[model samples]
Target: MALVCFGIDKFPDHCNFVNGGDGSVSTQTVEKTSTNRKLAPRYRVLLHNDDYNPMEYVVQVLMSTVPGLTQPQAVSIMMEAHTNGLALVITCALEHAEFYCETLKNHGLTSTIEPDE
Candidate 1:
């Protein structure tokens, strides 16, 4: 008579077992079952105020470079940058924030990304 069992570490007692005709026992222990998963760090995309680019151009760039950014949102960001010297355009994954910042830079706008805290 043999018994084989398989179970996750989180629930050691909760197992599925099978009986073998021979007198042997086997058990499969599931490795660490983590409840918490690490998430990728987020970043903030910022647009800096610059004298070179026009307000309308800034708005256009904001609208086009960042996904889901509406015209009204773009205008608001541009205005904020104009008044405050900088404005947060978006908060997203590092890669996306970098891409957006670079795209804005390509259009002659000052942009930067920083880890979201």
Candidate 2:
């Protein structure tokens, strides 16, 4: 009938339930339901090779469009696209991926976003 945590919240996860009639501790265990929240789905922003935009331009655009992209990282992404025909620029939330893809397109670069599998 009384909830006693013994003044500590982390000793035993379950609280002891007492029965007033028999003055005996009940064996029924109280379980806490853990919240397993699924994360928001992410999308991958991809850069495609194009003959129109120069390699330097693509690197610059990538650097400008995606924050925290260093020059070396941008160069690597550009090189990947140049050599393989396509490269993943970033894997992020849907909105962010869309914005990055559109920004790259606006800069005359070939860019697309696909759901990360």
Candidate 3:
């Protein structure tokens, strides 16, 4: 690319400059980003403590939905939900979080997903 200028009396007929044609100069920079791009909305799925759901059942649900959570970890989460009236079950894409919430509800447990904020 080139830029040119023209004047009637004060300047020359034209002034030209190469913008970016050779390898010596770069006109644009491309940035590489991480491949793990997140497209879905981020959500926090929470389990609400309730009288209808048994503690053991809560633990089971936690273990199943939360990836890498063990039996003891599930129990701990259950206790937190029981005592605190609410506990974060998982942080994930909105679709998965909603699925988890619905599964918990199907199991007769009170659950919901909200924005992480």
Looking at candidate 3, the ten consecutive residues that score lowest on lDDT are 23-32
Candidate 2 residue-wise lDDT, 30-102, digit = tens: 6777899999999999999998888888889999999999999999999999999999999999999999999
How would you encode candidate 3's per-residue C-alpha lDDT over 3-112 as one tens digit per residue?
44444366444433336656443223334456896677789988899987789888987777667989987888789988999988888988888898998888888898
Q: TM-score-based ranking, best first?
A: 1, 2, 3
lDDT of each: 0.84, 0.88, 0.78
Clashing pairs in 2: none
Report the CA-based lDDT of candidate 2 relative to the real structure: 0.88
**Candidate 1 residue 91 C-alpha distance from true site, Å:** 0.5
Compose the digit string of candidate 1's lDDT tens values, residues 1-117. 444454446646545444555654455444556689789999999999988888888888888898889999999999999999989999999989989999998989999999999
Q: Which segments of model 2 are wrong by more than 4 Å?
A: 1-33
Candidate closest to the true structure, highest TM-score = 1
Worst 10 residues of 2 by lDDT: 4-13
User: TM per model?
Assistant: 0.76, 0.71, 0.63
- The top-ranked prediction according to lDDT is 2
Given candidate 2, what's the lDDT at residue 54? 81
